[model samples]
Target: MDELTSFVALGDSFTEGMDDPGPNGTYLGWADRLAGMISTHQPGLRYANFAIRGKMLQEIVDEQIPLAVGLKPQLVTFCGGGNDLLVPGSDPDALAEVYEIAVADLRAAGSEVLIFTGFDPKHTPFLRSLRGKIAIYNSHLWSVAERYHCRVVDLWSMSVLHDRRAWSEDRLHLSPEGHRRVALRAAEVLGFKPEDDWSTPWPPLDNEDWMTQRRHDLKWAREHVVPWIGRQLRGESMGDGLAPKRPELLVFDGLGSAEAGEAAWKSAHRA
Candidate 1:
């Protein structure tokens, strides 16, 4: 557990940071937050993010993993297969087999690996149906982490994430607040001492009417769910023709957590 000075992240939209936008409207997800935390101790930290939205697990293995291996960063975070498990008739058992090869590759290349389990999706509206599938994949991820001696972010056991505020309107990505908490958790996983606690509960809120809730669900389905289904049917991906935004392991513009730290982090990205 030496202080990891170099890091590479590989994943999909979740790692690309969809809903957690920076001040200039760029995505600054948990990875950057964790980098910022690490930089406090390891100022020479160099980081790269190979995550893109809508990337499948195989795509990540084929494209991103090789690049990461070449960089030979001290640590690699692999968190894909979510988009894979979401497809109808997709097999979690089969996906886990593919996932292990990627992890094994990273580990064999002399880099420590970190992996994330799927979150508990029961509280999510349309995605609640995929709960059992997600659970199955999460179990496999846990076993993989154990067998490979990799660090676990364990997103499934993150109780604070169950709150509605932790999710974006699309219900697939984390909100800014959700990203904040996740960064703290990631820092904890890496043994970095974050200033805030991720498990702190939010203040109580008033409930909406049942009819209003129904209307919101319908709106979500029409806007987000329908488009997602169409893309799946068409074999299209949001990451189609898109390259990794942060391809190199240099000083990422926004790489910090906490309120003041986040402001500075966003400003760095703006430069």
Candidate 2:
């Protein structure tokens, strides 16, 4: 079998399961759901979620990518930089540069395939002011993925019909149902699963009890289940950090870690 053991999810609030008011939001975002799907259908699979809230493109370049490479995942996912668009100054070109660096690093670390996600304007705030910037960044994502021969998951076009209700109250995060749909679309795009495979209905959340239950479930998913599953996938004896065979987990060397990034770039280029 093609050892699809280690799968890692990287990015920001959306990746971390932010607004979704279900078991998924607290931690079991689509990454977790996909992991679960893989496990249920294909036993012995393992996965990890390393997403953090409020992260930007620079952060992924400097920090998240390293962490992912250390795991030695056969498959990896990057869903990032929504917060970059939240403000200004960091233009799409700058963000694209960051993405380019991260992708290069991923390839060097032996990740055979990477799944890169695009932004969803429907869920995006400040679109009127930031449309061009978002489009540029998304375009960069497309271009970079193409360059790297990585798969690009177009979340932007997929989430258009889903309105605010599909998202959480903050309008920034996805609702549980919304996350489920996103997972389905992502799976479809990545060829992880077929359209008919998404027939399993996620728990609906229209009332307070469902909301409260979802909150608790979300917490359990992140703080407990995710880490546990990650550990299992790595095939290591019980412990933290990454397996010995995996590379060092470094998201970015640092914003100004020029020496570190230069070393990485040189090393990767040589490979």
Candidate 3:
């Protein structure tokens, strides 16, 4: 809040910016977008993103949290457990307990911690059954934020995401536009004056027939869901060969220039 000089983000694909591909095919999610915004205000801002796709909550805690705390950044944003919630027999309360512990540790290390609630899956086809689990997790996340005095980017309350355009075809990650809106909302939460309104209504949509919708669902299942389940059964992850995009806190190279720092960062990474 006090003109962040250093920031670190920890989470799964949501924070990793899945589906929001950059020029080099890496993610450029809300965290990177928000970091770009912060750099505009303070060009020398140092940022790191420890988020990796398909990571579970415990894996984040064990792998990324300690490193984030070690960085001692002025700001840290963490969002995880969505992957865990999808697994059969997962407990929301149990997940929250571990999550809270990580939050507490980060706060104890003298950083302003930011956490996010799970998005509602009501409108996401094939994911409707997990709505109750996500709700329970979100409620617990709110309580954790309150108790820890941490800031929250309440994704659950973002009605804009209820629109189908906000979701990727997988229905798990957000589309590019959706990530942009989320970055704006995160900026708002961090006490920054965002240029655009995240709550702005999306344009109207065309209606589709039931048979057409069913065919789309089947295609989605075949293309996305089946492979996801296969990976789960094989104990494989999307992040198997991946590493964090920004593993260290460094000055945002393209800050405040005509080309935004995010583009510069992407280009630099590609090089």
Candidate 1, run of 10 with poorest lDDT: 262-271
Runs off by more than 4 Å, candidate 2: 1-3, 21-25, 122-125, 159-161, 195-271
Ranking by lDDT: 3, 1, 2
| Superposition TM-score, candidate 3 onto the true structure | 0.93
Per-candidate Cα lDDT values, in order, are: 0.84, 0.59, 0.85
Candidate 1: where are CA atoms >4 Å away?
23-25, 256-260, 263-271
The residue-by-residue lDDT of candidate 1 on 133-185, one tens digit each, is: 99999899999999999999999999999988988999899987898788788
lDDT for each residue of candidate 3 in 1-271, tens digit (9 for 90 to 100): 6767999999989998888876566777788888887776677999899999999999999999999888888999999999999999999999999999999999999999998999888887677899999999999989999998999999988999999899888888998789988988888888876546789899989999999999999999999999999999999999998899888889865323343344322321100
| Residue 164 CA displacement from its true place in model 2, Å | 2.2
- Predicted structure 2, TM vs. truth: 0.67
The residue pairs found clashing in candidate 2 are 62-251, 62-252, 63-251, 63-252, 64-251, 66-250, 67-250
Writing each residue's lDDT as its tens digit, candidate 2 over 136-203 gives: 78888888888888877676665342455566654456776566666666556555544333334435
